[model samples]
Target: MNQTFDVQGMSCGHCERAVTQAVKALDAAARVRVDLATGKVQVETDQPREAVARAIAQEGYQVAAA
Candidate 1:
């Protein structure tokens, strides 16, 4: 499934990497793209939306409603 999330508190490249890594930890084949300026994260993964959101939350980022 493909999901787009409004992710807050991503200020730099490290934050981007952290979010990507966190999702990848859940699904190794997942594809993650982050737009820091827009605070949007577009992910293509097999995992459910809730699981992905929780992973982002666990990474210390807020996942806004889609």
Candidate 2:
């Protein structure tokens, strides 16, 4: 599934990597793309949306309604 999430508090490349890593930790094959300027994250994975959101949140980012 392809999902887009509205995230907050991502300010730089490090933040992007953190979010991507957090998601990938849950699903190694998952593809994660973060747009810092837009505070959005695009992910392609088989995991449930809630799981994906939670993982991102666990990375210290806030996940807003998509």
TM-score of each: 0.96, 0.95
lDDT of 1 by residue, 1-66 (tens): 889999999999999999999999999999999999999999999899999999999999999856
Q: Candidate 2 clashing pairs?
A: none
The superposed Cα distance between candidate 1 and the true structure at residue 17, in angstroms, equals: 0.4
Candidate 2 lands at a TM-score of: 0.95
Strongest candidate by lDDT: 1
Query: Alpha carbon lDDT of residue 19, candidate 1?
Result: 98
Q: Kindly report the root-mean-square deviation of model 2 from the true structure over all alpha carbons.
A: 0.7
Lowest summed lDDT across 10 adjacent residues in model 2 is found at 57-66
Q: Show model 1 residue runs off by greater than 4 Å.
A: none
Clashes of each: 0, 0
Cα-based lDDT for every prediction: 0.95, 0.93
